[model samples]
Target chain A: MNYQSTELQHQLAARFVVGSMRGLARRRFQRLMMDIPKLRDEVAFWEEHLHELTDTIPIQQPSERVWQRIQSRLGWVQSKTETTSKWPWFFGAFASLLLIVNLVMLIPADPVIAPSIERVAVIQSSEARTLWLIEQREQRLEVAAVGAIERLPNEDYQLWMLPVDGTPPISLGLLPQQGDVILDLGTRIDLAQVAALAVSREPLGGSPEPVPTGPVLYTTDLIRM
Target chain B: MTTPQTLERDLQQIALGDTAAFRRVYEATSAKLYSVSLTIVRRTDWAEEALQDTFIKVWHRAGDYTVAKGSVMSWLISMVRYRSIDLLRNRANQELSTDDFDEIPATDTLDSSLDSLADSKQLRVCMDELQPTTRQAIQLAFVYGLSHQEVSDHLREALGSVKSWIRRGLESLKRCLQR
Candidate 1:
């Protein structure tokens, strides 16, 4: 009802996120999120802010059979298992290509166009322990996990370049769990303008979309090396 | 404990029709989300069905997930809870009362959820500041999926008073959280 008003929008959004706005009112709010940008933002704001309520409720792990049934429902078990086990070699070959490319990029006489080694970042845990070591050589970014690392079985840690201008963080690529991997540093990255480097935990194949789908786990200022 | 980023990444993959990522998402979130469903639907079989439906919807709607709405876990939990609520309503319409439902067992583990975010931590501190009854009312409405009338019945308060308490409590919570 009359969601056009700012106060009403916030109230409706809040109620929707908190799960009190039920049945038809909830459906209307969902429609509003799609049609109205302001209303969408308001709902997003409430979802982000009030999410702690659900988050703090104790975590309950579902039974293992649930996963088996889900896998069966999706028909992913047999074929997907084979697919994942075969991909590590591709990553290895990709890592080798980066070395050759780095060598070739440095050989060109055109000093002006050739990218240079500019900066490095060492992402550490909250306890001040280094987690990943990053170096930017020419246009290629390399990341290596340094300290004791615990990898989420089904997830990948993704690297991001944060801009100082307040734009959303840009994905650099997935970080290697065991060894260094060459990253596809997109052309849009400006070494001079980049404010920081951050890593987020993402799914195994990495984020399908451009934006980060997860929280920034580790962040470190880009220090010119 | 599943990180929000991991869930987000999986959701993104699932959106693009990655079945592997969908499985991973289910593995990471199903238990916690199932617990939420179980708490509401009060039957493991029904909760399991709700959990399955939730992920099916998640696979189809992964692209719709956005950080502005909340962390990936919150989004997943919301889907599960809503599905559980729908199942609960369906059963309620069929049965007069399910008062003999078994009680939820206390959690023994101290697993950190997506709520470990600074935003949630701050919200928790603020929530601790709310009056016990106000907090309970909000919890009943929110976590239990109880409506105003149901909350009034549980809290033994008038409908108008329950609505006002929850409304004002939420307003204060929003102010406190923003601060």
Candidate 2:
């Protein structure tokens, strides 16, 4: 499906834009689009002509907040949290943060967190500042963003499982920024055989591929409870 | 109030990291993109997210644009439509809206910017060449983001027949439009 003749390419693109292609067929077409730029051009043609049908829908203005959010996400206009969370002086020392985390862990019990955890891992930058806290519960995992993560608005951080058997890493899921993200590691992963967890910066929905197509940003061993 | 050419230049400027050009592009297109978003997603919050994601993609990927992707408006609308459709599927609040466009042409109710939508207008002209049912099926799928099965069910035809009409309709439209 990578590159069909011009006529077939045009046909696939048309079915794609016309909304008749669905399920695996649709997903396959998209992969082909990614590999073949000329195919993308054909999609653009169908998109150009058929999308005009949307003209029937009357114009509806988005609220001003949409623009403001766009600007905020783009780091154009810093929101309140973004401005205050610059972490210039506070996050400069990783030792102090680890000391606090250790003291908190000794706080008689983490009842609120105990139920969902068999182990935990933290992804840290080269500067040793924590970016995501990874909690493993049975086959499920939770990722929480606590640091001032550095990334473009269009980029997403995906978590991966590196196997001790030296198999290719399995995608846990996209790392969360604002909300809670719990990824089911599924039955494919054996807990004892797990080597380390890694994170990578991927395009918006994480890497379109099973493996990391982007740079491997961080990796750390899982900690036993 | 800028022209399509102005928007194209704005995209070019945006690639160079000009914030003013970015805002100009957003201001010029957001309403139309929003309309397309709302139509497909059916929920305001989801539509807003779709709109937001589409713009973020545009701001990041404006450098990827070429004339081969069609007009700037087309490129932008394609992004909006694809994102909105994804949201619609993921959200699963799906139902085909009841509208048979056989007698009522899509172009008949265009907005004030019809002059600038030369591609759209030319498409409508070419769409006129399709069979009424074929034309109706294609319109429902593209305009409303209906799946092939959904289109088949909506048109009350067998799934196989609906798919053929859509494929045939698109082939005919492509040949006609390219002419």
Candidate 3:
């Protein structure tokens, strides 16, 4: 129970780095680290030893909304907008015109026949290898695999639509490992408000639960074409 | 990938209350941090929540970063990892929810950008020396933030043995790293 014992300090430091130190004992260790420079050094030393293990976790980019939220939380939006004030009013008008054009593109009945692919998203692996190409078609979603993906046994890649409200992702169905597979999404999803497209690794039959049950492998923003 | 020098410079500017510098820091590191959060939390929304909170802390504590504290990336990761561990422990106690706690498939690979770093390469070489079971246990605990009991459930080992493997594994890793 003594924090000053060298043997205890090393043991606690190791557990803390390995993350076995928890609950009240963990909280005690945190305070000890703050108050004792030697204890803090011991923890930092362990941190250096174990920290690089993080490198093995493939880097996944968070959604754009993360920065937006950070800006909102930090009250930086006003400063950001002021910095972008150099843009002319004509630029705003042009953006509005583009939005109108995209809205009109969404009005058609049969999207395959209509020249109205308003948005496209290329979902790539962590290596930046393109895995699936998603395009918003009128009244449906079109998906095609552009690169070779080796499917893991007993596992399927499932797609989900990330909404702006931060709700659990809505399943858009499984992604093809090779070639192209298109499903006719009967109801028109509001692409404008959709935050991003996420792909998760799931069981072969896809997620039985409403939310994805496996690790999210990749995420890409839908771009207005 | 953000070079350490650039990240350190940006952190310094962020400490001085530069929003643009803060944005640069976010742009450079959010993805890696998010990946970490997602792996532990296993949900997009929670991961985003943790990432948001981590960045907010980064914004406020940018001044606290020093060379003695370790790399900028390591500091950022520790903040998120601890927050995520808190979330995991809190949720586990609240409902005994086994909903999101699943063993990650072996095929799931991490970011390739990690391979380019010298530190990563050295760590990988050291990690590769660990027995597969020991390595997996450590990975589950460190990467997924699984507690010893959860790791035991996933690995099908006794609770005491899981703790031994992790403790021994870290000791082995410490020896290997020191060499």
| Interface RMSD list for the candidates | 10.3, 7.4, 10.1
Candidate that would win on TM-score? 2
Record all residue pairs in model 2 with backbone atoms less than 3 Å apart, i.e. clashing. none
Please identify which of the two predictions, 2 or 3, would achieve the higher lDDT against the true structure. 2
- Which has the better DockQ: candidate 2, or candidate 3? 2
How far off is residue A151 in model 3, in Å?
Answer: 56
Q: Candidate 2: where is the Cα deviation over 4 Å?
A: A80-225, B93-120
All candidates in order of DockQ, best leading: 2, 3, 1
Q: Can you tell me which runs of candidate 1 are displaced by over 4 Å?
A: A55-58, A75-225, B94-120
Off by over 4 Å in 3: A78-225, B94-103, B106-120
Worst 10 residues of 3 chain A by lDDT: A84-93
- Per-candidate DockQ versus the true complex? 0.19, 0.38, 0.23
Total clashes, candidate 3? 2
- In candidate 1, position B3 carries an lDDT of 78
TM-score of the candidate numbered 1?
0.55
Please tell me which predicted candidate would have the highest DockQ against the true structure.
2
Q: How do all models score by TM-score?
A: 0.55, 0.64, 0.59
